[model samples]
Target: MTELQLTLEEKIGQMLICGFDGLTPNDHIQQLIEKHHIGGVIYFSRNYANVKQIADLSYELQQMNAASSQVPLFVSIDQEGGMVARIDNDEVTLVPGNMSIGASRDDELAYEAAVICAKELRQMGINVNFAPSLDINNNPKNPVIGVRSYGENADLVSELGIATIEGYQSSDLAATAKHFPGHGDTAVDSHYGLASVPHNQARLMKLELAPFIRAIQAGVDMIMTAHVMFPAFEPEQIPATLSRRVLHDLLRVQLAYEGIIITDCLEMHAISKEFGVAEGAVKAVEGGADIVLVSHTLQEQVAAIEALIGAVRSGRIQEEQIDVSVKRILALKHKRHVGEYEQLTGSVAEQFGTAERKDLIRQLTEKSITLVKDEQQLPLNLSEPTLVIWPEVRHHTQVDEPIVQAYTLGPALAELGANVKEFRIATHPTEEDIQSAIQLAAQYKQVVVVTYNAVSELHEGQVEIVRQIAARNDVALVVASTRNPYDLNQFSEVKTYLCCYENRPMTMSALAKVLTGQLKAQGKLPVTLSPEYSFGMAAQ
Candidate 1:
């Protein structure tokens, strides 16, 4: 038996993955598949209405490609759980993020999280999940990857990352280890501009590249390129997404990764601002990336496809190179049993937000809450009234969107047999806002202040609010709902501190329990906060 060969247009299409605007298939995306023969499509939160809608959209996209192309389309999503989940709705179960697993220091929990996520994604007709971010969060100032990373230590990151890869593959969904060669140590966010890593090769091997090697050895299906520039690997200061030396000589030749290599979204400012979208796509292919992701704008996707076709015709990009990439892409599709189009059949409604799955989420969250510092103020008297100060914050990666409303713990606290009063503040609180919160705290017997991502300089206002409230009230407690534990270094006057890692619903529920002594704090610090509070320190 012989496999069918793809035409030049079809082969070029296999190298490009695009994103569209509508929840359902639109005219532009349909044309891209029917005429242009695009290899895949990536879904975002904007493309989803509910679980049924997302599943239908995925089925429709596959059917459209089946009508014209020889290969079925690859439907992918960034269902990394926690804050990075794309299919978050009432029907979907939200799991703990990567750093929560790190805090537990349990590799089995990490593997279980991946398995649960894979099952849910497969139920929705999604074949690929871009997850298990292999970056090690060594720098506290890294704006993009905080709780998304496993931990700060290379060995722990390696162990947990490999576990996640195995879990996803076992469940029949292809797993992707993202931002190759590590994006954890960089201070800048690639979404806004180019980020650079100044470490030399030896340093990289010891800290950054360690986990990626483990993932490759574990047989990861795909590896995504980072847009950050590594001066040590490529002297020309080119980003890893466009540098041949880093992708080809290092990853392919040295690391011997036979899996498909995909680029981070070319529309990101790191690539689009430096090189035009079309030109960046061409360079990504030449640099040994099997898939070039143009995740926004139909015009940009078409320009990238046309540019690749022209490059092949002009002998700038060899046809043989294109064939190699298409072959790898086809091989993955066949392995996943998605190479041929077939109508999805089964009752997926039973799998979405099942009681069993939600229990796993609760278990992970309860094991990840770290109580870094506590005086005698913990487990506040249930009979006394307390003021809950909540600060609304925006995700650092999603800077373009409006700020999220304050996530109040008052309701959860009140449910736990306490008299709770809610006081909300803006993401960036004004002087009057801080003063008002301070005045409100004066009337209560105790005050619990919640700060989200206050470790970054951008959230200094939140840190200042904590300082002001702690100065006036003797019974003020600080809850840092962020991955970075260094926020505690700012307010030394605060008697009690808790690190919730993330502000997900499960984590919030777990925090409420811990405050009331219903659940014991067993999670340790995954990373060192300061000299006094080192790794693995937790309140007994």
Candidate 2:
């Protein structure tokens, strides 16, 4: 079906990609598809259970949409791997994230990982993957997007980002390079509130925008807008999701990107709490976003479509403008073969999570384990009693799920027959928790302190606890960051440090191997840990 054939309501519906409750297709989702004619659906951990279930659900959603809308639904997921994967199960290949790939200093690994992830996603009927985050994580204080981004260097990020983009496209999956205009320099999380980048056009172009420009030139399938505000681009304090100057004037006109432009979910506090999602959706479309994502609410999804239709009818946004977006959406769907109604048959599930794939993923993880520094503590004696100070599992950001945080280094070490005694502390340790942890460390011959993105600004308790524990002269101490490597900057006095860049089971297993001397720490630092530690600094 062409753009002209779609009604104004349908056109507006195509601009929205909504999320609803339940693992299966519920009434709200069906209404969005059959009745409202939405173009696509976004999958989250709430919508996923396991490999086979999600695969079947994707197929069912496409089949249902095909019967009503004529345009097949874009089954989309944020399977960027590492910390942000939506469908993480034992039956699927758990690819390491972009930063891990960057640490390996091999663009081929980035390509290979993306190819494996894309092939697995395709088997599950997921045509579009919001991946290859090109944001440069230059600021260590960034709460979100720490390990999701490739690295601090523009050239490295550009090389790896393009490599990943090509990998996904080669497997016929629509790859999206996300959080455009950059979201890597902020201290705030957009899920909680608005964040802004205060750089001028020259600095942004040199640092933040470099990877995106390379991605556009590489012919990336889509670009996802950031909710971050840039005072340099738009004078108003609104985020890029609602700024015409940022999205249309800068990205579309100045950059000349013709691919699909998707907004980061309007339901996020950055947009929803400030401007309201329904109004934000209309403004997103006006700002040159082809797809206005509302990831978590049914009422907001319906209201957004209604508001967009009202905007067109009232001439606040012209019908021709809506047509332009619809045309691009249709063109990309046809180009990617997502518009075709087809069902995957013959147990594609068997191809996923194979021993060979697991081996490859394990190798990548082992290669990414970075030994930042070591003070004659190359490998711990498993014969001696070791105390593992583990943080109580908590959401790192609103984007994180508890399931993703379930894996830990303590269990992985115990499984290896290490004499490990685990002590769980709060994510942000209390004064009593810190004192208790300190006394517990005194009882052991060796101590391993694991941190989860404990930047000094927010997680001062975790930082202080590690600092005081490392000061003990009687016990051997080794500090490791299981999430972001930036924790090293908080406790520079610690003589030994390592970073795994994620808390995934694979990463935990790899860190265990490194500690036991089963594998060497061969990864380089993807980002600058501090003034004392530069990019590519690693100790063998």
On lDDT, the candidate that comes out on top is 2
Query: What lDDT would each prediction earn against the true structure?
Result: 0.83, 0.87
lDDT of 2 by residue, 1-540 (tens): 899999998898888898887889889999999988999999988888877778788888988887887887888889888878888878789898888888888887778888888888888888999998999998887878989988999999999899899999998899999899999999888988999999999999999999999999999989999999999999998999899999999999999999999999998989999999999998998888999899888889999999999999999999998899999999988888885444556664568888888887887788889999999986888998999988765544566676524557888898888999888887777889889988888888799998977875556778987888877887789999977888887888898899888878899999999998888899999998777788999985
**Candidate 1 per-residue C-alpha lDDT over 251-316 given as tens digits, one digit per residue, 9 for 90 to 100:** 999999999999999999999998989999999999999999999899999999999999999999
Model 1 steric clash pairs: none
TM-score of each: 0.96, 0.96
lDDT accuracy of residue 254 in candidate 2: 97
Residue 533 Cα positional deviation in candidate 2, in Å, after optimal superposition: 0.6
Cα RMSD of predicted structure 2: 1.9
Identify the runs in model 2 with alpha carbons over 4 angstroms from their true place: 340-349, 404-407, 415-417, 430-432, 456-458
> How big is the RMSD of model 1?
2.0
lDDT of 2: 0.87
Clashes of 1: 0
